[model samples]
Target: MADLASLQSGPLRDLPYRVAWRARGVHAGAHRGTSSGAGGLFRDLATLLEAPDPRRLDLRASLRDPFEQLYVRRFERSTAITIYALIDVSASMGFVGNMRKLEVAAAICAALSFSARRIGDRFGVIGCDREIVPELHLPAARARAGAVVAALRTFRPTRRGAGGLVDAAAQIAGRRKLVLLISDFQIAADELAAVFEALAAHDTVPIQLIDSAEAASLPRFGLLPLADLETGRRRLVVLRPSLHAAWQRERAEHEALLASLAARYARPPFRIVDRLDWDRLAAHLMEARG
Candidate 1:
């Protein structure tokens, strides 16, 4: 398990994240906002007819053009981004093989909220299962990383359906906020697909939480009885060498399909719950910034 204190205090304490998509916030911060302002990051050159901002006219560009058409500079205004940590507190997340997935989720949430605070971004947390957990919904605020961590610590995985993701995503405002979605994706592809569609308006960062045992080799010879965490259905089956190999292949294919779908919105980052590494997550955040 990751040390919560380490996340709150260390070299990674004030880790910064790069926003992949432009934010639509009105407050002044780090991310690029949709609304243009007097002073911001220079975007590119544009014709005066297109921009209509005479004050931004580039005198040199206008002189270079033979036709002498006026050129204006376009800038992207910096705005404070609202970072939301949407965590899945379903029964599957409680899988305690080598480490509890719920603990991993909470740790990640702590790190993200602290990082957001360091960058002057508003931080929020939404814990959901079959339904949204009202008590766990923390509205976006600055310097509330400790409160977010405390709320996540109280969360316990319960047996809940996976139909609330779309509804939960809808609860977020359509202001192009940054959503750090952490989940052990045990739901069906069709259901998860709806969630992606609902959250298309925001910049979602998918952190697929996986138990180490899930990716490891299974017993080649055993009569294992597996029970569905959500449905509570039990099935006993003999695990042969062939069966184990087939399961591995199927899991790989499913992961590949998920990666393809997730890439359309944000780069997917996989975190093994048993051996959570902050450095690996930092690298992913850096890549995401690009």
Candidate 2:
């Protein structure tokens, strides 16, 4: 913990070490407490988001490292925008929480922030569930990213409060900037058209995290216990064939609703990412550079 506190407060020398921390989800808390888990590499990475806006690269610097600024000076145009990381920390997110979804989503956002920085776009962090956790604020500085990631890794979701996605979209600034909503997306967030219409004026993308059980529709043999990770509520529910079929039906409907929203909010040229392959999340990460 002492080392965790110190390293995040430094720069240059701490880069490699911090990267390891964030990559491995190392720090303090359920999602990040240091353990010999498989997520250690990303734990280190979760900690690397501590750069304060590479201040050396200003508008005049053409959003490049100083050397690159000199080479591409003429081609640089000003369309600087902002990218907001709108994450849901609702308890359902942690129902089976092992930090994989939360960790991956944070890494994706960190990666997005890195790419945004390259294009002269600013990054801001927002963690919400039924309500806003960290009041929305800009994190243009590199150092702020670690804080953002740290907060995210510790964010928890609940069962009762369901947030309004459209309302969250209105909290951001910059039309050029994109709002990324990352979640497991289990609950019905209302009518698809209404949700997309609310954010029609802005650029928004919803990233869903589906666990293996959810993907394969694991059998619910005998009496199964379902615990609400958010509310700490538990119930022994009987799983029947008909119930499983109904669940599958609802999941399909949920996906269709998501597709409809994406279709409505996007144009051919700037089409939103509609049901990206969870199995190939890495590919999406590499290709989603805007």
Candidate 3:
């Protein structure tokens, strides 16, 4: 378990994000939307009868009309959107090194919840491992951030697999949402592909949690005792410079594969290595085209 005091000391700041595609909904919000209403970006002009809004009548356009037709200035309405955090709570997420992976995930969720509510957007969370954990599920709502943080502080990842992610995806299938898929991504390649396929409809952003001590900071030569968090398997091996080099090469290859896979279904994965960088994450969210 992570030290709650340390996690609380450096609360993540609210991040800025934008959706490239036009949002679809009727509720008023901070993002650009498809609906035309009273106030927003000016879309186009329509005849008075078409829009039926006397308040929006364009006097100049009416005067220039050859047939003396009245025109109304139409504007696109800003709309609200749902933001969900789909968290992978598999045993690997419990790993603690330079930083606790699950603790970082929880902090992100807290920040997102606060930010979403600040902009009048609905926020929700789903924790999954072998199956959806009912206690860790929060339905989309305009809830207070304190509630979200409190709930996640008690979350413990003890399960083996991330198979429940597919099931969680199904539950939020109808409307398009800003889904933040937070995980260490330790699942098999085929399983990860399947999870991405399941969440293809939404605007998914992959947030990979990483700890340097996992692979990068090992001693050149030592007797290492390693354990698989998911499988509960243990091994003691002699670590050599050659072995370290091999491990790093394999890690790089896996990273490349993850990036390739993410580009196909979502934006490039935003990595939180050792610690989270708020500015980098905000920039990634704002600039991602996919």
lDDT to native, each model: 0.75, 0.50, 0.85
By summed lDDT, which 10 consecutive residues of candidate 2 come out lowest?
A: 14-23
Q: 1-290 in candidate 1: lDDT tens per residue?
A: 43434533544344457777677767788877777777888888889998999988899999999998999998888888888888887778766666666666677777777777777788888887888877777778886566656666766777666666677788885777777778887767787777777787777788887777755667899998887777767899999999998988878877876787687756675555566677777777766542
TM-score of each: 0.80, 0.60, 0.90
- lDDT (tens digit, per residue) of candidate 3 on 66-99: 9999999999999999988999989998887787
Ordered from best to worst TM-score, the candidate numbers read 3, 1, 2
Steric clash pairs (candidate 1): none
Compose the digit string of candidate 2's lDDT tens values, residues 1-290: 11223223333121100011111222222122224333223222111123233322235434344543321111111234455766666666664322256655566565666555544445777776666665333444433375677666565555444364445666664344455667666655463355466656555666766555435654755687876665677898888888888888888888777776776673212211222233354343323322
Ranking by lDDT: 3, 1, 2
Candidate number with greatest TM-score:
3
Number of clashes in model 2?
37
lDDT of 1 at 102: 63
> Model 2 Cα displacement at 225 (Å)?
1.4
Clashes of each: 0, 37, 0
